[model samples]
Target chain A: MTVIEDALFDLAEHLDHPGGEELEATVLRRINEPAPFDASPRSRVRTWLAVAAVVVVIAGALVAIAPARRAIADWLGIGAVEVRRVDRPLPNGPSTHTVPGSLGPTSPAVDEGLQIATAQRRVRFTIAVPRDPTAGTRSGVEVDSRTPGGLVVLRYPRFTLVEIASQGDVPVVGKLVAPGEHVDPATVGGAPGFWVAGAHQVTYLDRSGRVRTDTVRRSGPVLVWVAGGVTYRIEGLDRVTAARIAASVH
Target chain B: MHTMDRRSDAELVSGARQGDLDAFAVLVGRYRVSALRVAYGIAGSEAEDAVQDAFVKAFRKLEGFRTDAAFRPWLFTIVANESRNRRRSSSRRTKLDLQVRDQPQSAGAAVDDLVAQRDQRRRLLDVVASLPDRYREVVALRYFAGLSESETAAALSCPSGTAKSRLSRALNMLRAQLGEEVTL
Candidate 1:
């Protein structure tokens, strides 16, 4: 019992718990401050003003979508991925269902999706496999070749990895993130990336800007990065595991 | 520099109850790291704010604190509550990342052995992180915050027996997953 207890403490020491900074000053400062009035008219006015400012900003972004979209795509572009901040609520309709890898009635790409060997042979770039120990053997693979270079989806037991080759001045993959959803900067194999947490919409676009309805789905937390001109989207894993796998991709 | 005060927590608590801000400040300095650890386990990124809030709340409610009771556990209860509240309101579970130690392996250690140990530690961390919130909370309060079983129970608002059983169950699960690799 003592051994296990001591071992637990040793392990706890390695766990990177945050809040290492000196907090005494902040606590004392807050204590010295007067208590806030919860329902004061002044507080309510401040709240409304903040909400009004957010509304104006969101409205401005929406109205500027045409020119803003391209600039955003270029600014946030990592290899073939285009990251866009969308202000509207995610569609609640059955068309944008949460069931991942399932194609809609109108989309026929699922039928066209190929096996791993086939996907590897069909794509121009190398189809790298995740080398993380827990990644295990890929259960299956799906290839979508609507663009110049194909998009490959590798399905693992615990998560999914999607890869797409870089397209110059055009994005083969698009991520539309809503307000409050996080798209934190990350690094994959020494290359810049983005980690999107919470529910967000992912869209696959062709050279002509046509949405690949079959690949469209609302995704969960995903780590997106580009290494060797291949944009990789690892989904359904925590950021740390995703990063480990991302670093191990070969 | 101001002279260091060697007063016990009881003395500080007593002084704090009598509106001695300096006494409370010392108490804060002593327990801030442990309080933050508990808060971080629950609230993640919002832990800094949560810890500060917990300390303030503990200060305001100092009058109710019994001098006979252990100060750490009592303060931990408030910290846990404040952290849980923050987590509940945010509705986002921030993943905790375990860092590698800065020190190198011993001179006799082989590269393969170092790699194996690192991998084992990563797997252990993953298993710990994946544990259910209830089990994780008990483990965090006990191991991470260095709280005793009774103190963990006090912080969690549960019986000491419950805390003990939960720790046992959590350890068993870790052992089951880790197998012979877990020396403990």
Candidate 2:
């Protein structure tokens, strides 16, 4: 890179931009302030439907019913929920995964040497460590540097992993479900969670917002939950086991 | 909380089109920095106003945005246009202010090195600010806002080739202006 180019990049990376909260408040105030014209009836209907669907999901009222899927798909559009079920078990070895679109690529490299205590200090959010470390099970952690909020992965022996993030709004990487898979709503430690069974395709949206299929697929049963401002995913464990481990998090 | 953070841009745009202020707020929060950078690059003194105007316009015209397309470039296009409009209406060119608040010095850096780096950055910013409109906008979108060539094109409302050529020309201008002080 040329010196000027390097300087440009340095400025880009380091330049202090406006804080999000202030801008959000300003924009929200402006948008919410009364406007001269009212919204069209069609827009009102769509808004009602979208709000209703989100409320249902957050309230844990939407079961994995076929009809609800269509509503969610329509409401979410490109961010729709997809479920697929596969007949075979997921592979045992390490697999690479990618997040579609602007979220950037996923890394499978585990930080084998990082201790739970050290990771807790490095990350911005609270780190939930599994209280009951299964005997003879090796564990590791990896942090994806590219993501703005930072993605932390806790890997256990046999491909079981837990992905955690504090940004509750961003969707988890991968398809909502793989082929022949099922997503069942559940509660972990009194927080909302999902039980994902079987392997599923992961889809990403590139910079252009076009969906790109990830080459890597995740198999086996996985449990996902959000609590105390953190979202956690525990994979390769049964519902009971996952629940137990989740409850034991410190 | 779930409604605000988890939904994709398309979903947020849909909600915003439907007059969901919360959804719109999320979008604002997500792109505010990039929008500000793009606006500042073109409009300088009126950057803040340009951003506000662009976002307000974007909210009002949410229905026109295609849900399948990328939101950043689309939003940026609006910001860029707002900057241009502001620039034309005012007919005044304000120098870009490159001064950043002093951050705590890094562990090993000496005070002298930091001062020299700051001076160098200021000089580079001056050169960049002096470039012609076409060149300045391209440099801002590509380098300042960190958009790819295609994205910069989208923001500029130009063809990809046009954006690329403009950027190349901008870099050459910067190199020429800076002379041997900075390498391009």
Which candidate achieves the best lDDT against the true structure?
Answer: 1
lDDT per residue for candidate 1 within A79-143, as digits (tens), equals 23333444556553445421223333423343243576788887778999898798987787776
lDDT by residue (B109-156, candidate 1, tens digit) is: 898877776665667767776777677778778987899899999988
Cα-based TM-score, every candidate = 0.47, 0.48
| Model 2, span B1-184: residue lDDT tens | 3334888989889887655777887888777777887777777767778888788778866666888999988988888889889877875655555444456789899999887776677778788778878898898898888888899999888999999899888898888888887532
User: Measured against the native two-chain assembly using Cα atoms, what DockQ does each of the candidate structures obtain, in the order listed?
Assistant: 0.22, 0.20
Score residue B66 of candidate 1 by CA lDDT. Answer: 81
What are the clash counts of all predictions, listed in order? Answer: 0, 18
| Cα lDDT tens digits for candidate 2, A1-250 | 6677888877665554444447667666555432211222234234233222111221111212222223334445533444333343333345554431111244342233577676666667776667675612546666654333455667666434444443433232434342345667778767776676665543332221223333334345666666665656666677787778777776
State how far residue B165 of model 2 sits from its true place (Å). Answer: 0.4
Q: In terms of DockQ, which candidate is strongest? A: 1
